[model samples]
Each structure stands twice: as structure tokens, then as C-alpha cells.
Target: MGQNTNIRGIVQAAVAMTTVGTLTAVSATVSRYPVYGGQAVRYAVAAVILLGVARLRGPRPGPSARWEWPLLAALAATGLAGFNVCIVEGTRYTSPATIGTVVGSVPVVLAVAAPLMEGRRPAARIVAAAAVVTAGAALANGLGGGSLPGLLLALGALAGEVCFSLLALPLLPRLGAVRVSAYSAAAAVPMLLAAGLAVDGTSVLRVPTRGEVAGLGYLSLVVTAGAFIVWYDALGRIGADRAGLFAGLIPVSAVATTMVLGLRSPGMAELGGALLVGLGVIVGLRRSAERPLAVAAPADHHDPAHDEEGHQDQAHDDQHPEDRRFVAEKAADHGV
Candidate 1:
């Protein structure tokens, strides 16, 4: 493995774990504030906190460039709107365990997309690693226990996540992580509010409990604002493939948290599934280091964790001859 790729692999691993952790925390909190409008309110609040931080530290988003608006739209669609709605609705339709399994496929998506989008091919080792991750996720979902729709909902969430990762690419380099997060977060509010108003008019006036308020505060201040900066910065440096891998951590955290809250203990299948994902990530990432041209920027120069690839080119076409032929055309040179 080249030193550069090795570092990126580590970054992606960390981000993936953190991503899962954030989801576990936020989702548990959401049990308190289930309203549709809550999405916007939380992000709006988070954006404010991010902006405050931006003022104190230098902003991650620089003067900026062309990729801002489209990236913002992507964030609004994937992160703010679709992501929230899907999770809530999906949960209503299916089981969280099943959904977690399906959502876990993101690493596979990235594993496939990375090569094709980069206008290159993935090392055989990477493909193997991705396959392992995919299989592990399937095992987790299948054994974790849920209905068919439950599985589908999980897949749906994964679909949204894939879209979010691909779409967020273009914005990272120009905006920096924090600026992009804050802007998209702020931008998402109007739509969230509209959804709430359209679906439930009294959403605005509903009384919030102490837990709900605290949940909202955490979602906004910590999850949306704080985590995003770190995540986006990771995305910018390491490329989405590595960043997406962070997703595996979510199920692990969820299971652990569930146990902690005394909701349920991790089942054998879930544990096996999580272990599979962890193994797959380790294999794929380490293999990436060994392969030539595996990451965006040289890891030695910049933190491998930085996101460098354009979000649009997030696929790892190494195994997918079935993928669209022109994926590479839109690809930005990562870490150049």
C-alpha cells in the first residue's frame, strides 16, 4: 500500500464510524420529537451554531466558487429533506434492523462507484472488500429480523445516502466542510417548514417537552452543524468512497445504544453483520492503499481523511460493467 492511500483508508474508517455514532444518537433522540417540521427547526438551529463557530475560527467555505449552489441543492434534497422523510416514513413502514442492513450497502455502492467515476478501475482487492461489506450488510439485515417492507425501507434510506454522498462531492472543495454544511442546513429549513405546514399545520405551535427541546438542540447544534463540518472536511480530503464507509458504524452504535437504553441487546446476527462490515471496510480500505491511484489527494501531503473527489463521481465502477458509460466524464480528479 502506498502511504497516501493508507492514510485515506484510515480517515474513511473513522468517518464511517462517526457517521454511525451520530445516527445512533440522533435517531434515539428523534423518538421524542416526531413531527415533520422538527427537521427544519433542528437544522436551522444547527446552522446558527455552525455560523457562530465559523466566525470564531476561519470559515471552512472560502470566498467560494461555482460548485456551491448545486451542492447546496443536493444537500437540501438528500441531507435535509429526503433523508429525514425517508427515515421517519421508512421506520413507520418497516423495521429498523432491516433498514440498517439495507442502508449498510452504501460502502458497496461507493466501492463500485469509486473506480468508474474516477475514470479508472479498482484493484481486485477493493472489489473483494466491497463484496464482503455488501454480504455482511445483507447478513445483518436478514438475520436482524424485519418484514419485507422493513428491508425495503432500509434500502430506500441507503438509496438516499448514496445520492447524498455523490451529490455532496462538488461542493466540498470550494465551500470547505463547515460553510457547506451551514448553508445547506439553513437552506433546508424552508422546505422542512413547508412540509410541516402542508402535512400538519399545528406543527409550529406544538408544545415541546424538555427531552424534545434537548433533542432538537442536539440535532441542530451537534449532529447537523458540528458533525457535518468534520464529515464534509473528511469528504473533501478522502473522497466520498472512504467517507461513505463511515456508515457501517451506525448499526454498531445503534445496537450498542439500544442495549444501553435497555431496549434490546444485540442479537447474534446483528453482531455478525457488524463484524462483517467492519472486516469488509478494513479489507477494502487497506487494499486501496496497496493499489495505485486509490485515493483523491496524496495522503502524505494532506490528511487522507480530506474529501478531494467531486461528489458526483462517487462510484467505484471496478466491478460494474453495467454502470453508465459516461460516469467518468463527470468525474473530477480527486486529490490532485
Candidate 2:
């Protein structure tokens, strides 16, 4: 099971890299489109796609409590709206490479925050790997000139990236990955629209060009709707600390996209950074030989048909009470 989880994490990480990398490349077209306007369109379309997916998937496979709404809203606000706004607004003042370098520290942020949030220090090797990933991000992005405002905006983006996964952990057992993703995207639409109106004025209401529309579609459907589901699913399976390290691949993927698009060939720094990010992923994903997972009790002690579902339940139960409360609240709805 651990091996399978690691494999899934690797696949999910690849998907995430592809998602953000495509965003980096596609965003070049948005130079003509107002940033906020582009984001508003992206989330709106994403919400629509997610809503359809939610409907098709039927009701979530478990009971739910209304209390999960606030967490979902926060996830939408920070991860979807605030994060994109920071990147877009930040880019106006600084280069995308600068933004990428700042955002690349997401694993480090998660590693540090894990102790505060979960009351356990991350593995030393994991923290070291995260640092290596951060260094790779800087090198791959070729850290260069940036203003104070741009740096601050990039920090805001970093905050959003951290919040996205951390915020989802508490709700994973209750809502399931797809539903959590769907709800967040749906909730973010209004937030993004209001932000777009504030930032871009009447321009937000204008029809986008065909090229902009293409970019918007890809961002909405592929990056948001598709990537969010995969990311949260992997987070549930493998845990966030290990999964977050994979985020380092975003810069590498960006370099790959550039090479494919013939924008520019990667230099020594990019190649070396890509290798470091790969090494970090390998080191971070390795399970400790001395600290094997506790063996589960006999099947007779659990529901025979529910063995698969039990793992996810145990994952949630291992969290802090604050993290477990959402599940407890929803379990109460089922009288469990």
C-alpha cells in the first residue's frame, strides 16, 4: 500500500507540474487580457466544469455537515482567488521567473507549518529535501530583478499555495477529493469575479479574444478542475508533506514547456536545477526503513467490505483534533 501511495504521489506530482507549467506558458498570451479579468473567466469556467462533475459523480459517498462550508470558502478564497491575483498583480511589477522562485518554496512552507498545525516535526530528510527543492526553484527561475511590491505580491502567492493543500486535509475524509475540489472552485467564482471588477473595472465585462478564450479554457478545465482533484486525492493517499515536495517540479515543467515552445533553450542553471528538483522528489518520497507504518488489525476487527475505505478513515483519524473535528461533525450526521 505504501508503494502504491508513493506511485500515486509521483503521478499526481507530474500532473500538478503539467498543470502549472501550462499556466506559465499559456499566460504569455494573457498580456493583452487584463490579469484579473483572465482569472475571473478561468475560475468561472472551472466552476461550471466542476459543477457538472459533482452532478455526474452523484452525492458524495458519505454524509456531510454544514460546518465544512467555511473551510471550503477559505480554500476558494486563498487558493483560487487570492493566489492567482497575487501572481497576476505581482507579474505587473516583476518577472514571472521571480514569481516562480517565490512560489517554489511551498514545500518548505508546508514542512515548517506541519509542526505547528499537526504537532509533529517533519522528518529531517524531508525538510532538507524541501530546501533543495527551493534552491532548485530559484536556479531554474533564474532569480533576477524585482521590486518590493512585486516581492510582497509573490509572498501573498506563496501564502495561497500553502493554504490550498493544508486547508483541504481536514475536509478530505468528509467530502472526498473530487467534492472538496468542486466546492472550492464553485465558491471561488464569485470571489474572482468581484476581484476582477475591482481591479479591471468595466474591462472585466468585455468579451475576450479567441486566443484569450483558449487560454481561459485550458486554465479553467485542465488546471483547476482536473489538477485540484488529482492533487487532493494524492494528498489523501500519501500525506501532504511528501506530496508538497513535488511542487518543486513546477519550475522544471516550465522550463520544459519553454523548450517545447521554442521560447528559449534551457541553460546550465535550468538543467542543473531540474536535476536537483528530481533528486529532491526521490529523497522526499522515500519512506523511512526504521519507522514502518503500524500494521492494521485483522480484517475481522473492521468491516470486511470496507477495507479500502478504512485507510482513508485512518489517515483522517491520525490528525489533530482541530483537523479531525470536521470528520467528527459529519460522522455525527450519519449517527456514527
Where does candidate 2 clash, by residue pair?
none
- Give, for candidate 2, the lowest lDDT window spanning 10 residues: 292-301
Model 2, span 117-223: residue lDDT tens: 65555678878999988888789889866999999999999999999989987777656776787788878878877887887778776788888778778888888
Model 1: CA > 4 A from native: 1-16, 59-67, 141-155, 287-294, 297-336
Model 1, span 211-298: residue lDDT tens: 7787777767666676666666656555566556656666666666667778777778778977987897777556333333234432
What does candidate 1 score on TM?
0.76
Off by over 4 Å in 2: 61-66, 290-336
Instruction: Write down the RMSD of candidate 2 (Cα, Å).
Output: 6.6
